[model samples]
Target: MSRMWLCAVSLAILCALSLPTFGQTFSRILFDTDMESDCDDAACLAMLHALADRGEIELLGTMISAKFPWSGPCADAINTYYGRPDLPIGVPKGKAGIQQGSKYAEQVAKQFPHDCPLYDDAPDATRLYRQLLAAQPDGSVTILTVGDLTNLRYLIESEADEISPLTGQQLVKKKVAHWVCMGSRYPADLDPGKWGNFKPDAESTVKAIEAWPTKITFTGGGKFAELISTGKRLKELPQDNPVRRVYELYFGGNVKDRHSADQIAVMVAARGTGHPWKLVTQGHNHIFPNGTHQWEVETDNPRHQYISALADGVDPQEVIDSFNELMLHQPK
Candidate 1:
């Protein structure tokens, strides 16, 4: 080869070597949500897309763990509004899963400009999870949830299939790094039995907790008073923004008295505990099938912990602001 041709070949090889290896860059996230009852699910969806738009994370897809009339469309509407209408979506249409009614999903879908004509028209979340996880490199993807554990349980219990030869738990153990979620009050502040998401699908939640052989991080279940999130401010967005509209319908244009657990968890998943956020990993979480759970703090080695308050001197307002900036962020 001539000197110039060899130089060009070497340059091409260098460029190839510089490309991101599935191992490089931001965390790969597969977000699962129970969009049935909370508008924060929509807000978290917006934040994920915002992070994606900024190249902070690659949003593999979103799955709706709860079944509602227009849950899938509401998610699609947000994805479409964010200029990523082609993003894959999944939902459960099975009787074994949690089925909850949504106050906003149906209305938002009917009023929004998205292309989803039917909510259940989407694929199954379990299958989607398997296919997505199977294709990802080992310990490279993060499955973040802001909803019931039904889907997590179902996905964990899924058997080996064409997607990959690995069983559900095996696939998770081999592929997923950890689970970032927003549910179940920690420290036993409230009865774990009555915990919101866990009890709705208690059996599934228990199964999910037992099946997963990895670390699970929980955040925002009436524990972090410093991370309270409100959608009243999101109501300020112009009427065309479907996310804002979803909030309006849920909170009745009032952001006060609402928690941002789901949004904060998603933000933590995207931005990590870089500044204000901190983790309490000194202990593990204790979950039960009756919808009750608690954080067992231990000084010895432990595996689970929820999000603690802001780092020392970090204003509590900044904590919520972090969530607001991303949750209400517009697509760039």
Candidate 2:
């Protein structure tokens, strides 16, 4: 080829590479949860809104796992608080097994027919997963699981080929790039005695860890939850504060209560500001008879990734501080 022609071809290739296709920042996030199970999930949903207010993340959808009976109402309450009652909210199709009669329940009901509609009739989580995953660009979505993994397991097993067209590993490599899970025990460091959320659906939790395409980060234990408290932060702001309203409603005048691990996990996934996460080891799929899920390092799993550190520990702190600051002021 002539020298001029070769130069022109090279320049064309460079320009094509430089052109932007999609402007999505930090990919997309899908928050899968059993919200009615705990106040932390509600708090986390509030924190997510705070981050969104700062233009740091994009929330794709919210799915309710089978762990909570009133998942739909809880999801609606959260959506209503965030001024996104139109966002997709999916609930489990079958029985939710657990009963609800707590402060969380009363708080969730306050939103009632307005923000929290009686949407026990929406599409199942698996169907919602298919639609969201299919519509998102390749490798641009992160499934943040803060509750039981039943919804994710259903998505993987039922819609495996459709949602993840590539091989189990390849599909994860291309479509769902990352999973931030808030379950499991941290061995000797943070024991289960410190946190009560990991006790639900241990079997499904193990299945999720095992089946997840290795690119998953497990943020478990009570360390992250203990470091930050929304009670004092919430009170620092007025009742109209978006973050405070969610916190106060869910917490119901008790602000010192520790939030959910799922909440912390989502914050880390979205911002990782104030909480320091240590990537101790890779996760496996082992399940105990008691339904307690456990994870160990595996050298063979190429599709897995446990967060060793969060941008030199700057991300977690920044996230916590930002949440505090946002809650101090009213949403613009």
Candidate 3:
């Protein structure tokens, strides 16, 4: 080979090796939410988009488990803001799920730019789940549900349809690598004890957990989420940002820091148990009929685990700073 050609090829190889390839293989994720009440869901969605921007996770689709008129649109609005305007958005079609008003869903939907149809007009969440799962490779998708289990329950119970011959449970068992849930309290949710996500759709929560075939990681951020307050940094972003609007509207014009359970859930789903989080895989989360739950020691089933703080725990401000950086990430 000519010396010039050899030099050019060598330079190319050197440059390729120098380029960063960290987290190159993206984590495939389907984010499901109930974005009608708290603002944390919106923050979580924004964090997902931000992680996608960083090439850490490939957001296959977003589904809303609630039955609010504007929740899907608000999710679409955030997706649109992050430059994925056509990302699939799904909602519960029937009146079987949580149907409530939001402090910000409507206002964010009205103010932001999105073409997603209203709740009733959107695609059914269960069907959407089946379709998304069937199309992905076996054991490749991680479902992150930071909401009521309505869609997931329907998915678990669905019969064969035009999408695939396999039932919902079969499809999920074939395709899903694991599930990361942002519901229920860890160890136990005692006393008046039913987390909002579980209580609203208690039956569904009980059923989905009982039937889900793969391992589940309950990212119970009840205590840590409160410590990891976020959303105030969103005010530093431009006024056109939908997430910024969500915080402002939810808090009555102030972008105050709110509990970050949903954000923590997203982080754990996209990235594994890193720093501050230690996985306890020795027990199973036992869900009661009323949607309340407790972690019981078990050796028979190893399909369930939950996150807890490290021995020394982590500085809350450090977590807040890191999460805010992700939440405020701009669309690339």
Candidate 4:
């Protein structure tokens, strides 16, 4: 071929490679969890699977944030049920203590095997976070934290040197377009107990918010997950469904009411729906001995961003309906 013809062919190939694929629109998400806290994590996992089935999001990793011996296998089993056993699961290296009065502890102990096998060969929490973030294009990733912020803190601290001049928060601000977390309260609502999955390490949470470089949107309080009740909605699925089975075993056919905060948090983080909740502009104030953290709205506070409007009213029925549709339509 002539030199001009060869150059033209190379240009054509380069253009083809540069064009984005059909699947590129979906956002990549890292689902950080502390499973033993509540059933909301399980519900959140179900929501993630539903979205993946609909091609709305790509699940990068599911790292275990706190040590709940049974959580590893429980997460693996749930992932296996969702048909995405390849997803990585990470547990805190060394930590102990189940969140107070965990109802799932006995269930997890009875159900999850002692020799809990990991579902995939994921690196430790820090490395996994770094790998996923580095692999994605800048400003394209969204880190969704539904559990404790341990893994996120690790990622921020470990990768700080790589971003230079950009602190972990700054890097997250620049590279990660959004950080959606499920913690805190609605303004001066000093009700920490009401914030279901946020008690494990309130101090860490305070530090994380203080250190966070970008604005964060939170979804929780007395009103967030108050819509979904477990009973009939969970029973709607066949026993074979992994999530349904876990639900059955844990609640024993009596799934009258349960905490849905984590699930609602996941949905808001993943889909950006629900009521317009307020954002804590001043970041975290003192975390009291009772677990509640304080916040004050500031005109130009750089530490945090509070979302006050309830984008939509709480609709557990709608959530359940969406979940059913996703499961029914999932690819064979």
State each model's CA lDDT, in order: 0.76, 0.59, 0.84, 0.60
Q: Which candidate number maximizes TM-score? A: 3
TM-score of 1: 0.86
How do the candidates rank by lDDT, highest first? Answer: 3, 1, 4, 2
Q: Can you give the TM-score per candidate against the true fold?
A: 0.86, 0.74, 0.91, 0.74
Off by over 4 Å in 2: 1-25, 67-69, 94-102, 112-119, 160-173, 188-198, 240-252, 257-260, 272-276, 281-285, 295-320, 326-329
What TM-score does model 3 achieve against the real structure? 0.91
lDDT value for candidate 4?
0.60
Worst 10 residues of 1 by lDDT: 16-25
Separately for all candidates shown, the number of backbone clashes (residues 3 or more apart, or on different chains) is 5, 16, 0, 15
Among all windows of 10 consecutive residues in model 4, the one with the lowest summed lDDT is: 94-103
What is the alpha-carbon lDDT of model 3 when measured against the actual structure? 0.84
- Show model 4 residue runs off by greater than 4 Å: 1-25, 94-123, 159-171, 189-195, 228-231, 273-291, 299-303, 306-320, 323-331
Top lDDT hit: 3
Q: Which tens-of-lDDT digit does each residue in 1-332 have in candidate 2?
A: 89999999999998766442222245478988766656667667776666666566778888877434456676666566667777787765644223333346445555443343344556777777777777778888888877776677666655355545544434454678778877654542233444343455555555556667646766754555555544466666655443455456565565554544555576567753234555554444345644454444554355544442344546555646755664453445
- In candidate 4, what are the lDDT values of residues 23-119, reduced to their tens digit? 2345677888777656657767877877776667888878877665566667766666677777876655524223433456446545533334542
